[model samples]
Target: MGGPSREMTVMRIPLKKAKHHFGASLSRGTRPYNEDAYQAGTIDIPAFAKRRPISLTRNPKGEIKNEVTPAGSSSGDPQVFYFGVFDGHGGNECSGFLMEELHKYIEDAAKDFELESSLQIKGPVHRYIGWSGSAEVDEQMPASGSAPETTAEESLGAVKTYTPSGTESMKPPKPGSKHDGPTPGAKSRQSPLSSAPPVKQSMSVRKAEDLERELVMDWKELVGGYFRRFKPEWFSMSAGGRGHPAEQDVIAKRHYPNSAVPNEAVEGIGIETVLQYAFLRADYDFVSAQVGKRDEDPVLADRAINDDDILGHPSRGGKSIGGTKRFKGGSTCSMALVSTPTPTPFWHPAAPSTVVTAHVGDTRIILCKTATGLAVPLTSNHHPSLPEEATRLRRYAATFVTDSFGEERVSGLANTRAFGDMQSKRIGVSAEAEIRRIEVTSAEYSFMTLVSDGVSGHLSDQEIVDIIKEAQTPEQAARDVTSFATEVSADADNATTLVVRLGGWERRTEGGLGSLGTKELRDWRKAEAENPRGRM
Candidate 1:
């Protein structure tokens, strides 16, 4: 947990030989209080090792009953590792919520995914809302009236079929077909088909799109349900733990297409999807919570308070700022979920793992390669300046202005996507996460660094990688990263760093800081030349 404390908080769990260990360091930097948080831990996945045999028994009426025994749980070490860094803007409430509860939601998602995978159980989405397993019916009804239950196939039938236009074909491009357009994250270049008519989505693709959209909506509403029940006030208490009314439909109506999903629910559930669910859920929860009772209070609805104003609220007593309670604000989220092979050693040189990352706003995750000592970005920041993001915002008629410093902002917010910021949500400031997956090999990658803008704003990706590379341990690396940020810039925002040592920890780096180290060596020589052996 992180807050406004002046002293930096550090946490680490040392493993044998320091392999596959993690460390987190958070500091207030030059700010009055810190609004950043980081969480690192392993999630327990039940390993069913044995099962009891089924038996037939006689009931009271002499009717034969079939009895099935549940599988026995194995007490094995948890395999899935979660590491994240949250940069809070308005206050620590959003980040705090993420720190305290986001992992639980992720765990639940994982459990549900596993259940679906093993037992082929397609549990109702309502099970997630308010943590109610018995609540099967969608509490959220249609605007017209309550509708009868329908299967996924039936739901697909209700959606309109899409037809292709121009040269577009319903079938996917043939294998090995050359694509003139640049790949994702590649430098934008002019393409011959840039001006071609847009291809329409096929019905199968549209069905997947609808499924994905509904999943997102359901997760968001689930989080919103928890938020609605959070307040101790009479009205909220009387509401009896329900999600926001009509808000779910409002979000569903939004035209955000191409959020594609594989039609197979069981097989399609992956770590990337789980990460997205966690992020979207938390974002919706925080922002929807702030809008509570806003209609009754004009000030709350019409005027939003900055972090400082919220901290200096006259009603507050002598307590320090950046505590958990907050009305409004937002935070950028960057997280890495590592799925280690079950029953196999993790972070071992022999073990290969997959890292699935979810990111929103400017917070970032980078992997340090052992061979080149280079920083490989795992996530891209969601800034308004990005051409794709700018176009997306414009599609929703949202406006952004470039500051005198040339930083693009959406309604005075630096991040185009983040958690909370209720007002910004209306203008297409989305909580939809950008997800990426990578396979990690112990021989190639050394470790990963998750950092907030406080450090990233001042330090280059390679510089941060170099700083961490020079440290002897993950804890030291995390501390040095935050400390070096403030040393480089006194006015750095709340600095935080999370270093997770991979299987290739402490491997010799050929780069060895290269120019960065050369500059230091040059400076040291110059200093020695200027001063005599014992001169003071």
Candidate 2:
């Protein structure tokens, strides 16, 4: 591939025709630690208030139509389905935390966008990030090879806020499950300290570590408080300004993938600002939660522009109720939010009215057009080797060094941007995400592939498309893609994949509660997807 002849030959090969499939798979590649994570579900507009669908009469005097209505819950107002993949790096902490909170938080933020469409109200900007682990500890936690990757639900307990009270619980991918974790490989990560700092920790490093714990707790409380209940401060940034110019044509093209309204009647709201707000907050929290009051970091200036006061007063508990411990870990994430003007549909809840693609780090969100099988990438990688990202690293004075593995890392990290690398953020490794507007037109659209770098780093997008085309079903495509990478990729780290299809959600009208949709698909990759170890 080095010479002009090789390069020309590579380009000469025709791109494979894209195909549409309905299967989904997740594979943990040849890594000791399977840090990759994913979540797919429906997000409904949270009601400003709670009301039981059917309430019993208290003394029957105030009848008021409170009789036997066969209590059924509302599907959700302006419902949208979400699919996300978190590629944890330093550790799984950040990914675990994000899997739990990111979608719910974005749901809360969308209220502002919904209001913008109407000429009536003014609102404030609300921002927060759900990062796991404490920044004070620079050491990676002990690897849990035998343990299953924890669900955000189990990790955070029951997050009672906006989640539907009676909706069935989402199950964690079971052990021995196909789409669970890493492929059955023993390539566990060696000690991260292999790239040690020094015989003795520097006074500066010690000082930063001690201070970071308290600072991280501040943002944790701020984010946790937002989930407890709503306050005026959450909407302080709502006073509207014409947000970044969105693709004007996006609104007109997308038919209501999941929405109750038609495309012609839709209005493009100011959601871009909301996306930026979420990205900035995740990075802001990461940096501020790590550095001292005196560190002369450039991001500090952007901090002033964002303002910490936006969080209102920091609560006194100084602890997250989620009971999620602070660990020294980082994770890369790609989340897709399909916002539409639907009042919320009944039978077709998971339809694709694609609106926004949000991301950070190398996890990629790729759009595959089913009509022509054209592959459209929605995100660009944020890695140190990338020219622009490396420039930002140099500007921030990141101590770049080649690790024992001959891979360039920022203070021993493989990637440049993430949710919870307090250590990296101190040296200006930010978590600011790049948000893009994508209008999903049903006619030209197909399923989307959201994956961690383990897959992208090894196989090209075209190759993945080829696999999709060759496989019989979407699930098989996921399996083939994951199996190929684990068996063949150069690094074979944790490979997690989510194949999202518009209009794929179908709820059973007869199931009482907590029942799975019609698709009885099996998961190919698993956290414990590794080979069974022999007894000593």
RMSD of each: 18.3, 22.8
The TM-score leader among the candidates is: 1
- Which stretches of model 2 miss by more than 4 angstroms? 1-23, 45-78, 111-269, 282-325, 340-352, 402-407, 502-536
lDDT tens digits by residue: candidate 1, 38-67: 887665543211111112331221111121
Quickly count the clashes in candidate 1: 0
Clashing pairs in model 1?
A: none
Against the true structure, whose lDDT is highest? 1
TM-score of each: 0.59, 0.50
